[model samples]
Target chain A: MQASLFVSCIVDQFFPEVGESTVRVLRRLGVDVDFPPGQTCCGQPAFNSGFWNEAKPLARRLLRQLEGKEHVVVPSGSCASMLRVFYAELLRDEPAALHAAKELAPRVYELSEFIVDVLKVTDASEIGGRPRREPEKVTYHEGCHLRRELGAVTQARALIGSAPGAELVEMEQPDVCCGFGGLFSVKYPDISGAMLADKIDDIRRTGAGAVAACDSSCLMQIGGGLRAQGLPIRTVHLAQLLDEAATPG
Target chain B: MEATTKQFTQSAAKTLSDARIQDSLRGLYGGFSKARERAAEATPGWEEMRTRAQAVKSHTIANLDYYLEQVEARVTESGGNVFFAQDGEAASRYILDLAERESVKRVIKGKSMLSEEMDLNRLLAGAGVEVTETDLGEYLIQLAGDTPYHIIAPAIHMSKNRAAELLHRGVGAEGREWDTAELTAEARRQLRDKFIEADMGITGANFVVAETGTLVLVTNEGNGRMCTSMPRIHVAVMGMEKVAPTLEDMSMFLRLLTRSATGQRLSAYVTTVDGPRGPGDEDGPEQFHLVVVDNGRSRILADPHMREALNCIRCGACLNACPVYRKVGGHAYGWVYSGPIGAIVTPMLTNLPDSRDLPYASSLCGACREACPVRIDIPRMLLHLRRELAEGRNKNAPVAEAALMKVWRLSVSNSGTLAAANLIGRALRWPLLLLGRLLPPFSRWARYRELPRPVSPFRSRWKDIFRT
Candidate 1:
């Protein structure tokens, strides 16, 4: 089966390796993947900022680029949710595009959503370094958009559990937002930091070696605080782990 | 004062950081959040009730003008005077003139955010009218000379120990370590004399029923009833948006409000009073006046994205469910109305420059939407306000932020560059990784969190597998 891989802009610009890991993991599962070069963003920032007028053109352009695709997958839950929910709202004035938006939404899936529901690959990946360190106990911070909006929490954890030596532990209110709403961070830094501080404390309380989430933006925000404190705790996108699991040690 | 969003937030930040106030807000966030969650679970049709309640509020707000007239006519016929004050100054002036005419020197008040918005206590105090707050929370906050942090629980930021100290100092009973009951007794002993001696008692109405010309006041404390009935002259200051189309509509809201607010089957007191006391009535006000203050609601009513905010029941359920509020608490909002409703109202009611900063206070997590009884799309409103801030609609935001968003808006609109960047992202993976470590903001991002490192070219691998 052919799949269109959407390396969400956040992953593409800052964390290109996530894009590579997604492709490797998908290919290992025998899924044919194509990175549609025409894709840039899902137009979430504009849509979330209430610039429906500005976001609509981008949404239309996005819909047009991936128009004929049967399966489109993204590593980020928020970008997927934008396509699932806000894309249609943005294009409301253009009734002609409604069919395209509706048709594209269900077919648009997050990484775990695609792997578990579509690919159904449930084995561990034999990655490099002879396990590197000890069997690391990691907890997942379920990004709000992915968990609450996209309902990708369980699916994300299931994929994590498929990795060898990666014991996925559940953090309390794993779905609570880590205060990274794109512009919300810079706009209200104090409140954002305060909220992130709470999330970090919750993650630390679980005594997990690292925090993993599907959205790079959320990871970036949570990771910033954890890194600032110089804690042993690290943050990674789930795609990286699953890709590592797929490789031979 | 034309309070812009900036001033509101600055003041709020100052208040939130105050050690004494922050200590009090700990209970406000924890206690209410736990209580509301438990209440929702116990109520069988909690979700259904919320849906129905939202529908009712939406319908009333949509046809607000008709309901306002209906309520006015009913109140007048019931022997009560209904005055529509276009704004706060007008509302305060009307109340002050009424008091002057009635020779009212002493005034008592029940918990009312609307009165606080109008600064009625200050206005009445300036006129040499001694006004006393009847609710225990309101009384403490009043003595402290501060505005309420939370809408429902006025002194929610106050600790019992702090309250004991504030009361001991205010009432001239120095050095007395008072318990909760003792604190209540002190408030009662002091307010009792004012409640009886005062010529007028001012209270805020929970809802104004258009069908029966009735004003309902729901409270855990019985002070609302006493303040309304004990005085010879009664004046209820309510925001114009508080009107419901009918008694049934009022009933639907009351159930959702209390359950969502404090996890109670019903508040301890729900009093519905219409007009003056009848000849046979035992104890009630003889002259009743209801001042409907618009303040800035009419402007909010004009904005399609924001008008639903006026439907808020002042139930702080959204506050309890909000993660942001839980962390910083209500004082962070820096207004009489805090939590999700404050995020919407403070900016809408105040000018864009001063109050708009309050809207950016949320993470737009939509928890407020789930907890809202009227189902006010608070996250949506916050986003809209954010847009306004981004677009330079807010008079208070820094010019630098606006310029940056303009650049951001321009860059995202074009696909060719964005696509090129997408491909470049796969190509320049090494340098970008270095950039993430070296850059100031990126360093900030990496400090608490880690961005995933992409292994190889997503586009080229896909091309080899799919298109080939």
Candidate 2:
């Protein structure tokens, strides 16, 4: 089955490697993937900041781009949530936009969700007939939008647990927000820093070599914090880890 | 007591840096939240109970006028007086006038958040009526000349040593090394005399039963019972939305309230005061008064978007679950109500412009919604308030923000403009990184975390793969 990849704006601009890994993982799993070139952002920043008027056009633009794709996959949970959960609410006044959003929502899926639910692949052996090389230790950070909004809690965890040689060390409150709430970190730096401090401390206690999350936004925040502290821990997107496992080098 | 909500940012900064407050907050975070989770797990059909409570509150709020009139009629028929006050100042004045008319010299109070909302103690004391707080937590904070740091646990921000010091200074205790038992006994000993000597008693109602004209109060301390029973004149103040149509509805709320607030099956005391002492009653107040204060709640009730906030039972569950409140503590909210409930209610009930920052304080984590007993959509309401601020409906909207959002909308709407911006961003990554350190706007982001450098845009990398 052919699917359209919704590479989020953050991954498009800041972390293209995550986008590349997402494409490789989807292609290797025997699903035809296409990038809808007209796609940009899901209008979360404007919508979340209470600028519904400004966000509507961006939502409409996305609906226009992804218009007839049977399956749409997003690597970022926040952007996927914007399309699947918020678009209809954001365009309630306009009938056509609302209808398009409603129609497109069921087709939208986060990356791990698409892998586990659609492709029925969980571990490395299930993909491309290869055993995986796993790091010494890894933990998963559940993004807020993925876990709470889309209810994608167990899919990513299941994949992480089944990675060949990696030991899954569960951090304390893995579902707690990573404090990279888009504009929140920029607006309230001190409070954002305080929350990230706690999150980093929790991650350190797990003694994991790397942390994995579904969304690139969370990885960037977690990676930035780890790098700033001079910690050697690595941050990997779930798609990147799955790709690493599926195509062992 | 004063409205410092306008200074939320400054106070939050101060609160974050204060080590003692953070320590007390850490202790509170574990104690209250875990107990609540355990209580919810142990209770069968807790979710069903919450739904029923929400329905009851919705029905009552929708028919508030009918139930309020029913309440007034029943109380009047039962030989009790009812007063309606439009705002906090009016409510305080009405109580002060009543106190002066009745020649009340001393007054004792139970733990009443409504009284706090009205700044009643300061008003009453300024009017020369000596008001004594009877609840243990309330009494300690009162002695320390501080407001409540929490709804259920008012002095949760204070340490045991701090409490001992406050008591030693206020009540003339012997020394500072007082244990919990010693402090409790001392507070009880000191408050016992005031409870008896006070000419009037004042308390807040958890729910007002309209059908039976009964006022229900749930408190962990027995002082709620004493505040209603010991004095000659008894007055219970409540928000206009606190009425329940029947005792059956009251029971459902009672089940949800205690479990949500303190994770108890029931509080230590559930006092039901119907009216003054009847002809054959042995011990109770002679005169009973019920003051229903609007104080901007009616305005909130009138607005369909915000009417859900009135369904709040003041359980403080949302506060314990809120991550922002966990970090900044209650005092940073800078109002009577703190945490999620405070964030919504303070601005809506008071000046929205002054308290605009309260709604933006949250990360919209949805934890408050999961924890609310009546299912109040606090984040949605916060967003609504943010929209109001953004649209310049409230005078506090920053013009530069609106313009920036407009520019962002224009930039992101077209794929070409977005791609061009990304191309520029990728090309200038190194120079921009250097400039980011010197600029204040970018420096804020770089203060605690490294900024991610822009990579080749996805459109450039994906052209080869999709070309085939």
Candidate 3:
């Protein structure tokens, strides 16, 4: 089955490596992936901030861009949740857009959900290679929209557990938000920083070498906090981990 | 209490920096949530119970006028009087006038958020009538001359040492180190005398049963029973939305209310006061009054989008579940009610201009909605409030933020503009890296966390690396 990539704007502009790894992982799974060049964003930044009018045009553009694709995979859980859950509500007033959104929403999937649920690929060896180095201990941070909205809690963990050289060390309160709620990080930096402090402390207790999450926004927030505190915990995307496990160095 | 919601940002910053509040919150962060989870798990058909409770609230709110009239008629038939107060000032005035006419010198109060909303204690005290808070938490905060820091646990921000100090000052207790049991006994001893001397007692209704003409109050401390029974005159004040059509509906709500509020199947005392003492009754209030305070609830009930807020049972499960509330504590919200419910209700009940920042205080995490027993979509209402503020409904909208959103709308509307902006971002990546730490917008974000530098745009780099 052919799939279209919905590389989120944050991944496109701030973390291209995540997008590249997503494509590589999908290709290695023997699923034909196409990059829909017309994709810009899922309009979450606008929609989430209560700018439905501002978000509508982008939602329509996204619907039109991936209209006929059988599967639309996204690396960011927040963006995927926007397309899969919020698009219909955002365009509820316009009949045509609403109908298109209803049709398109169910087909969009977050990267881990796409791989485990749609592609049915879990074994690291089935996709490609063995571990090139020692197994790295890693913990997972469940993005709020991804875990709570999309119900993709176990899918990412399953993918990580199945990867060749990654050890999944569960952190406390894995389901708590990472406080990188897009504008929330900038709007209430004190509260956001406090929440991140709690999250980083939890990560420290696990003593994981790295932290992986499905959403780049969360990784960016977590990574930024870790760097600010001069902590050595590396932050990575789940796609990069899965790709790294599947490909030889 | 005067509203500090307008200064939510400053107050919230101060609350966040306060080590005492932080320590208090850390102790309370997940205790309620975990207990609630266990309680819900223990109860069979918990989800179904929540659904049924929501349905009951929706039905009652849809026919609120009819239910409230029924409550008044039934209450009057039971030899009780019912008064409708349009707002907080009206409610306080009516209660104070009653106190004056009845020559009530001492008044004892059970824990009542409605009383706090109406600022009734101060009004009564200003009228030269002695008033005492009977609930342990409320009494401690009263002695400390501070407002309640939480709805369920009023003195949650205070430590045992603080309580001991307050007791020593207020009730002339021996200056001795006290534990929880001893402090509670001292509070009981002090309040017990006030309860006997009190000529009038005031309490808030958890649910006002329309069919049975009953006021249902759930409390663990037994102060509710004391306030309702000991005084010659009894007054129960509640928001008009508290009326339930029947005792059966009240049962459904009772099932969820205590579980959500305190993670218990039932509170220690569930007092249902039907009316004044009957012909054969041994002990009860001689005169009963039910003051149903509308207090901007009618306005909220009229709007289709905001009507769901009236469905709140005020159990405060939302506050316990909110990460934001857990951090800043209740004082940051700057009102009687705090957390997600306060964020929505404060602005709607008062004026949006005064509480404009309250709605934006949340991260929109939806934890509050998940915890709400009635399933009030709090985040949805918060977003609605935000939209109203942005669309010029309130004059307090920040100009810079509005302009920034407008520019953002323009940039994200089309792929071409976004691509151009991405190109500019790439070209200025190094400069942003150097100056980002010192810039205005980045400075705000960098105050607590580092900003991620922009990498090569995917459009430009994907072709070279991945496409080949």
Candidate 4:
């Protein structure tokens, strides 16, 4: 099965490995991972900043890149959901794009969603981890975009459980936002910090060796908070974890 | 009068950051938030009810013109005068004209955000009429010479001490600092005289049911009843979207409104007045008038992404759940309505440039989404408004934020450049930490907290670490 990659702007620029891990995981699952180089942002920064006009052009560009695709998989649920749920809302006036968005939407899937739904991979071919390392307790942080927007919480948990030798521990309010809402962290750091503090505290209480999430933006935040507090917990993106689990054992 | 959102937010942030102000706001927000959580948990099928409430609102707003016309006809048939105001100026003019016709020297008012949007107090006061806010929270803030910081609790930003001081100044009765009860009594005494002598009374409606031509008001204080009934002339100002399709819908909303707003089974009073006095109604106003103000709602409705904002019940559960609101408080929103709902409503209701900063004031936490009984997709709307602001549709964002975002768009749009930038960003983390601590923009973020350094760049460190 062929699938086009929608490397979220954040992963495209700042964390290419997330994109790499995404590609590796898809390819390992017997899916032909195509990097549609023309892909850009999901236009959330513009949309979140209230620049629908500025975002509209970008949305058109993104829609143009992946039109008529059988499957378009995005690493970040929020960005993917932006195209799925809000593109039509944003481009409501432009009926052609709106129609295109609607056609493209049902096919667009978050990573876990594609893994479980489209790729239908029950087991991932992991490369590196064969002999299980010391079993580590890890907790999952459900990014609001994934849980609320994509409604992929159950799918994410299923993917996590599918990983080899990884114990899935639930933290409190896993769906709570880590408060790193793109520019929001920079704009309202005090409140953002307070919210992150609570999130890191929740992870610490779980005694997790790592905090896992799909979106790199949230990983940056939860990881940042864990580091700031000098907490021992490591932060891992779900793609990287799934990549670890997909190691050719 | 032409307060841009930036100017409003700055002033509001100033108020929020004040040590004394936060002290008061902390108590206000914390109590309401706790109460709301308990209430939400206690109510079975609360979440379902919220969704249903939102459905009703969405259905109502989709057919707003029809529902409003139904309300207008009903109100007219009930012997009440209905005036449709195109904007704030028109609404104020019509209300002011009523005051003039009544020779109103004073007007007793209930807590009405619509009036605040109209700046009715200032307008009426400027016209040489005394407009006394009778709700305790509103009265306290009025005496403090400020607008409400919260929709339900207007004086949510005021401490007991500040309330005492405002009461002392307004009442001119000196005594040892008194408790809340004593202070409330003083306000009651001061406002009671105005209620009796006022030539006119003005209110903001919670829901105007088309079936009955009835304006529903939910207030914890008995003050709204007095303001509605005591005067010879009563005028109710409402946003055009405040109309419900039917009384049955009003029943569902009233149940949802109070529960979501103050965590009350119902407010102390839920007054539904239909026009003026009936045959046996001796104390009711002789003349009742309903002024429906469109302001910018027509524009909002024309644009489908924004029209859902018109469905707001003004319960303020969204505000209470908003983390940004918890930090900055309502005053920081720089508009009459503050919080998630306010961010969406303010820009649409007022001139665009004036409320640009409002949409950015949130963390988009979605807590507000959870709290909203009518289930306004506030985070979605915030993003919508943010898009509007970024496209230079707003006049308020600083040149620097705009420029920075432009550069951000450029760099993030490309893979190779962004990857290189990320490497440099990873390398400069140490220096950026120092710069963030010392510089202007970064200093703002670093001021209250410590910056967390990046672990090695995700790409550079990926292979060996992941072992995949």
The Cα error of candidate 1 at residue A248, in Å, is 5.4
lDDT of 4 by residue, A1-249 (tens): 988888876776557778878877777777876767666678887677765666787888888889988899888888888989889888898999999999999999989889887766645333334634346676888878777667776777876765776788998657667778867778766666666776787788887898888888888777767766777888888888887765655
What residue runs in model 3 are displaced by over 4 Å at the alpha carbon? A121-126, B170-177
What proportion of true contacts does candidate 3 retain? Answer: 0.48
- The candidate, 2 or 3, that scores higher on DockQ is 2
Q: Estimated TM-score per prediction?
A: 0.88, 0.96, 0.96, 0.82
RMSD of each: 4.0, 2.0, 2.0, 4.8
Superposed Cα deviation of residue B293, candidate 3 (Å): 0.9
> Residue by residue across A175-249, what tens digits does model 3's lDDT show?
777777877776788888888888899899998999999989999889988998999999989999888887777
Encode model 2's per-residue lDDT on B132-238: one tens digit a residue.
99999999989888999888989988877788777777455444565889889878888889988989999999999999999999998799999999999999999
Could you tell me how far off, in angstroms, the CA of residue B84 lies in candidate 2 after the best superposition?
1.8
TM-scores, chain A, per candidate: 0.94, 0.97, 0.98, 0.94
* Runs of candidate 2 exceeding 4 Å displacement: A120-125, B170-177
**What is the two-chain DockQ of model 1?**
0.38
lDDT of 4 by residue, B348-466 (tens): 77656667667777767677877778777888877767666666445456678878777766655545655665677778988888998887656765653455554444344333443
- In terms of lDDT, the poorest run of 10 residues in model 4 chain A is A124-133
Candidate 3 chain B: 10-residue stretch with minimal lDDT: B168-177
